[model samples]
Target: MEGDVWMKGYFRKRGARWSFTLDIGRDEKTGKRKQKTVSGFSTKKEAQAAAADLIAKFEQGQYVEPSKVTVNEFLGDYMSVHYRSSVRPGTLERAEHMLKNHITPAFGHAMMKNLKPLHFQRFYAEKSEAGLSPGTIKGMHTFLVTAMEMAVTWELLPNNPARRAKPPKQQQHTISVWSHEESEMFLQHAKGVSSYYLIFLVALYTGMRKGEILGLRWDDIDFEAKTIYVNQSLTYSLKELRISEPKTKSSKRAILTPVHVLQELKKHRLRQKEIKLKLGTGYDNALAEKYVFTTSKGNFIYPQVLNKALVKLCKELELSPIRFHDLRHTHATMLLSLGVNPKIVSERLGHTSIVITLDTYSHVLPAMQEEMVTNLETAISKIQTVL
Candidate 1:
């Protein structure tokens, strides 16, 4: 092609068949001119139509150069060049973990251009047969879809095959929450470990995520106003702790602190001060970082540490075991059960929308509905008796 004009491909008769040759472009890596040739067309018109279609695709920038790049190679390049710095460290870590453990193992050797929806369907079927949870399979599907989307964007593939594949349907599980009695019993047991009590209390009352609770700084708390400002979260990666922004815009919020919870926090601060004074220079200088929750030596608390502590406490108390996140759910459930407005509960839990709060805690609504019906019946009966 020259000066935005379509180049006419050469045609010839070869062994009673029509043949055509067209120059597409130069090799991206070697900078050599590349051409495509086809033979055995029954008629000249057939060869001409094929050549015209090819030229049109090239002109529209939709022509994908033939490539031997494997899915693994493309995924590695995509993660390194397109994904790594654009997302939070924790998200990047999860993506890398999923790619290494699941996606790369299954499809890495397959040529990028040869991947089809059936290949992905078979992969999902195998995973389902192997008893992988739908959630895990869905995560893998998301990662593959996103990677393939970038591949299409880079013109490494004609289109994203993952988009056409059917991923496993996400299975919703019942949201588990602690009853009032269970919450009280757990807190009673948690008090023995003074270091973790405040953390658990904050999670239970404020519904802050584990990372957000760990990320708290003394300056984020206002004792007189009984408000806690959540602006960041502490994330651990490669055994190093770093502060990151909250998970969503709503996660960056102010939570009204209960008076009793504030008192406990104040006492916890005094205890930390005494410990710091006793340790003197032996204290970890990192404690000066001013995280509200820390190790006995004054280092930032890790999520795993909190989880382990919660697990150990549950085992000791012989209570139903739940993840640390269950405390946040328990808080929302308790609030909604007490006739608290769903919007307020949504804001307290830092949900992006009331729809999420409703969907997540829909199991708790049946009881609320029953209560509403009973109240309506009672009001109507009182009016009828007056009449």
Candidate 2:
């Protein structure tokens, strides 16, 4: 059975189920009729009530068409169109990987408009039960909040369900850094055997990020002034390696280098030149931006390759294996222990704020506190003798 225009929308009974259709007016450009149909009500009264609310929204200019776009497809569009320009390649890559492996498998097939806060709440609970870290869950929550906000703005959904959902509490892990003796042992052991010696030295001495070190060009290093310019980062994006700007405004800084580190840098440059001469025109290093570090084939080195190399070298030297990033932490920890000003350390590490540097390194700075106490007591004793 079917009925015409019950409460400004058509109604029909198909077998035991009731359905409704609303006229959404005509398309201006095409002068064509437009309509929307929603079905699966248990009673004719229920279909009638649902259509009335939809009509009210349509009149108020607050109505959005229920789209067939699945969460997976919409998110794909969102990342490519919205996130491509806003985020770096490495960030985009990780986000996409997380979406593919963790998120999409849960509710990607569901209709985008039908997503509810409960769906996401269950997702977090399930992920937590599966032993995922709270910080990681928090990251996923952040991504959903942003993506769904964009959906609301684009009128793909009327509101952001993710904004109402709660994720697990955030958790942080202790940062690890090398001791001075271990740093010396590694450097001494690596100097003789490792091809990545200069790279490791640059990380420990400059406190630069792995991406920053990999992205360095020879011209960025000023041998005379003993300075290193951090301009860009080497990152992977869309299946290709590329260089992008630094992580933040402060990350692009010029670090003053020690004479010894610069001396080793000069030796590294000479070696690069000799390799270029041997490769002749076959060298990709002949490019305008001459990279400070590269593979024997003259191609830029991948970041993961460097991580693997560091791990293998640590095992060979019989030292506790640490991430390549931990070397930068080692540099900051060592300097703080030597009575270097916190502000100076912050600037050298290219932290956006000095507070970040202080908070991050405070756990490893007990020696610095002891040294400060001793100096303060000595100064008070000297003043007392004068009095």
Poorest stretch of ten by lDDT in candidate 1: 1-10
Measured on C-alpha atoms, candidate 2 has an lDDT of 0.89
lDDT of 1 by residue, 168-278 (tens): 898788777899899999998889864698889999998999999988999999998899999999999755788999998889999999998999988888888898889
Which pairs of residues have clashing backbones in candidate 1?
none
Error of 1 at 93 (Å): 2.6
State how far residue 356 of model 2 sits from its true place (Å): 2.9
Candidate 1, superposed: residue stretches over 4 Å from native: 1-63, 66-68, 129-131, 285-289, 381-387
Each candidate: what lDDT? 0.86, 0.89
C-alpha TM-scores of all predictions:
0.84, 0.78
Single out the weakest 10-residue window by summed lDDT for candidate 2. 280-289
**Model 1 lDDT, full chain set:** 0.86
Query: How would you encode candidate 2's per-residue C-alpha lDDT over 257-281 as one tens digit per residue?
Result: 9898999988987888887888888
